[model samples]
Target: MNSIIHILQTQGNDILNSIGQHITISLVSLLIAAVIAIPLAIVLMKHKKIAEVILQITSVLQTIPSLALLGILIPIVGIGTVPSVIALVLYAVMPIFQNTYSGLTTIDSNLEEAAEAFGLSRSKKLVKIEIPLAMPMIISGLRIAMVMIIGTATLAALIGAGGLGTYILLGIETNNNALLIIGAVFSAILALIFSALIKGISKLSLKKIGIIFMAVIVLMGGYFGYKTVEKPQVSITIAGKMGSEPEILINMYKDLIENDHPNMKVSIKPNFGGTSFLYKALKSNSIDIYPEFTGTVLESLVKTNKDASHDPKATYNLAKKLLKEQENLDYLKPMKYENGYALVVKKSFAKKYNLKTVSDLIKVENKIHAGFDPDFYQLKDGYPGISKAYNLEFASTKTMESSIRYKAIANNKVNLVDGYTTDPQIEEYDLVALKDNKEFFPPYQGAPLVSEKLITEYPELKATLNKLAGKISVEDMQKMNYQVAVKHEKASKVAHDYLVSHNLLREK
Candidate 1:
């Protein structure tokens, strides 16, 4: 219950931040859409043939998936607000343009004829007669566009565009129901309020109500501006794999700093998806920091021309040298121990077969069913690599997510499973993580990677994280992992407790 409340509070703030971003994206896009759409509608009203072609084009754009459109736009516009705004504007165009055309064209020709008969000039007929009658329809279209943009705006976060989508995406990724609800509810509220205000204004005299409505909006904007200015802004971008561990780690960092540095606000932008995405975020300076493994830095990023070695210190040196010289990035001191893959078997199964190590696995390998995570099984460095290196084959193989595989092993559905060395369940379930006599897997020491610019700007930040070096033993990490993955404890709380217990955080 306490966990539920804490999650709600955190997500509420996230939603608040998201609301601002969503509004910015929606309004900016709508404004741009109106500039282009209204003019097109005007031209269409004047030319019947052109109107048909343009409307068809907009209808086609509307059919395109927002996510796909954003993907197509990413390379051209790159990431962040620009592509997001363009996508939203494209989405907003059909309704506004269609409505504007319909509203202007539908006016009884008699009304227009009367304006001309009254000696009204062309400009007067348009400004005084045509637009006024079309006002309600145009407002109606704007309202529809506003609602549509709010819903579609959630996709913006996927491409690094900041907005309320952040909370929604985070909630979905972490399975935090509270965050999801908060983001959904508040976004609904924003759309509702805008729609209602527009509806009310459409009923009143435009000349009379317009100034007052604009004044009120400006006042609200000013108040929000003041509130934002008064609060200290501490912005930190964290890049990590989009998974349970990174989510917990980022939350932990947020809680620790917020608790200790009350006056110093902190914001954590989590880039969660895959290693490649996080790496790009770091390289582009879209993210300020992220957790990385030494071996990945050495093998994947550095590509050092050296034979594979399992020694942590040796790998660390290679990673550090390559990062400094080639990438202009720095690898902070590694955490206590390496987190590598281990071939695990349930206690009962191990005892039944008298299995102890990789060599022993070969003896009973033909009898055992193996389950691997889909990614792990498919990756070049995964099961295929292990099979080639160890020269062992299983009776049957199935691919699944790691969590599902763990459950399968627990239920005796599979006799052999791949497990992370630092997984807390290894200890909890009494599973044996067999030693790799052939050293097929490489070292994976956790560390923080910072860009050269960030290192120079925040000199103390690297040292602060480095203090964690050699402190978190494999056993310690397992316990922390259990607190998050099993016990359902908030990752931030677990991380904060660990930091305070170890005297890494100053007393409040």
Candidate 2:
């Protein structure tokens, strides 16, 4: 309990920031969706066939997976707040559109007739009679749309839009359960608050609620308007793959870059999907900098075959060459640590089977129970290729979160698991990583991939990034991961402490 409180205290600012982002994104999206939906509903009221087609289209858009939608939007609208809001708006439109159309069309016919008999024009009848009668239903739909947006906005983090989703993703990546709970709880609270507010508005005099809603819209417009005029000296977004090490590295880069270049504003867009996602984002100019692995660049980015030798220099050279020529990305100096996937098993299981190498898997093929992360399971360099290479097959396999695989092995739920070489859990859970005797996996040296355009703009950034090159070792990475994932320390704290200890940052 005390620990949780300490965690909360240390992360108060981040939590607050996330809450603000969540509210802005969701509320702005809701406003935009309502603006589009309400008028469309009115237009459709008289055109039943057209209304059905448009509603069906929106329904289909709503059904697309939020992550997939974000992925699609990233390539089109690019990343950050715009794409995130666009996705939320698409998701929010259906309920509001449907409700508005239903509410307007279902109004008592006698009231419309009476208004017409009183010599009211169609526009007058709509404003004074139909709309007022439909207010309850319209408000209900708005409430539903707002609530749904609040929840769905969490995914905005995936595309680099800061929100409560940042906390949740960071928690999962760093194995910090407390952060997960805090993010989820806060998001739920926000959803409830919005729901209650909407309900209260529903109970108010129509004029009162209308005025309040318009006020909110005006405030949102002003906020965005102000943002457009206020520009930083130099804004750079640092991105990373989803994990403790990448998270730590990117944050450290942000701190160092900002410290070295005080005039520059460094923003973080952490937890890009994987090698492909980061590659595409960097190529598309959606991100400015990120940590990447040489092996990933070799295989995924450069499209090299698996038979490629595990030579660090060769791998780095190829990666550097390809990134420069193809994507206008520069591969900065490599870190000492190698974070390639390791096939691990419980110490007892390894000892019993004398499984010292990946090839040993063939002996226990059908008897093995494997647990793997989604990435490891699906990647060509992961389970599928590894199993085929060695003619080994697991008796049963389950895909789960990367953080839980260690526990899965220790609890005897699985005999084999896939993990990172720098993961602290391997030591904590007494697991042995089988050697890749066949050299199937490539060398995965960590490095920063920076944009050439950014370098042209902020030339000093090269020196700032170079200061971190070759500083972190495999052991250092493992210990840091332990501090965050096992000891439950914050990633930022661990990163800062390491930087200070290494004399990389000036003391306060």
Candidate 3:
């Protein structure tokens, strides 16, 4: 319970900040949408057929998946808030456009005739009569659009647009339920408040726009003041895969430095999804530092065929040598243990069958159930390759999400599952990770990958992480994972305790 409270306290600021970002993105997008949609609606009313065509086009855009749309936009607009805003604005247009059209078209023809009889020109009729009467419906549409945008704006985080969605996505990826709940609750509140305010404004006299304008000004001032007061010097960006252990390690590094090295400001930028994403970010200089496995860099990137050895130290040295000579990058000293994939089964199930290794599993293969991720299953070096190498065939096979596979094994749904060697749950569940007698799986020794520029700028940074070398074994990592994954402990707390226990934090 204390952990829960601490998570809230630590992440409360992030939640609030994300809410502010979410509101800003939604409001800016809505404002742009309103400007474009309202004018289009007014013009289209005169040409009903044209209006129908344009609305149809916009409705189609709304149907496009948000993530796919963002991916399509990335090449043209690049990353950050611009593409996110554009996406949100595009999404918001249908509601605003529909509302404006409905409100304007529904106005009684008698109202137009009354204006004509009063000698009011088209402009005067629209500004004074038509708009005022249609104001309620138009505002109602804006209210709905605002709510929709608020919910959808969460997707903006995927493209590096900072918002409440960042917290929610991270929460889901890391299994941090508190962050998810907080992000959802606050975003909902913001949407409700905005909707209510729009409704209230619609009922107010014209004079109320003045009060609204003043309120916006006051809020902006306070926000700016807070930002200016808390601004830090020497901010550095640490990029890594979202929800990966590297991200957690980076966060630990940040906390250690912030408490010990006060001059440095560290911010985590989780470039989630795939390994290719991190490589691109690193090559493009969008990210300064990240944790990478030596074997991955050596085999995947460098493409060096040095006899396919399983020795991690040799792999690290070879990778470091090639990186320095070729890519002008630095591969730091490797950490204690290699985090590799292990074919595991429940202890009881393994003992019952007397299965001690991959070779042993081949004897009873037809009796076992196997589960793996689709990607892992498809990879040539994955299950198919492993199966051929070991000559094992299972009773049934299924592809599943990486997160779900562990649960499936624990629940006895699958007799064998792909397990990360360093996962703490391996210990908690008393699973038996079979030895690979053939060594089909390659080495995956953990190490920091940094640009030559970073090393030249801050020589101390490399040594900082190297100190954590040999500190975390497979068991240590598993214990940490258990704290967050099963015990429901806050990641920050787990990281903090680990750092303190190791004396990684400088003595104050």
Best by lDDT: 2
Residue 196 displacement (Å), model 2: 2.0
The positional error of residue 3 in candidate 2, measured at the CA in angstroms, is: 6.3
TM-score of each: 0.73, 0.89, 0.81
RMSD of 2: 3.1
Candidate 3 per-residue lDDT, tens place, 48-95, comes to 899899899999999999877876676566555678889989988998
lDDT of 1: 0.75
Worst 10 residues of 2 by lDDT: 300-309
Quote the positional error of residue 31 for candidate 3 in Å. Answer: 3.9
Q: After superposition, how far is residue 276 of candidate 2 from its true place, in Å?
A: 3.9
lDDT, each prediction: 0.75, 0.84, 0.77
> Which residue pairs in model 2 clash with each other?
none
Worst 10 residues of 1 by lDDT: 256-265
Measured on C-alpha atoms, candidate 3 has an lDDT of 0.77
RMSD values, in order shown: 5.2, 3.1, 4.2
The best candidate by TM-score is 2
Which of the two candidates, 1 or 3, achieves a greater lDDT against the reference?
A: 3
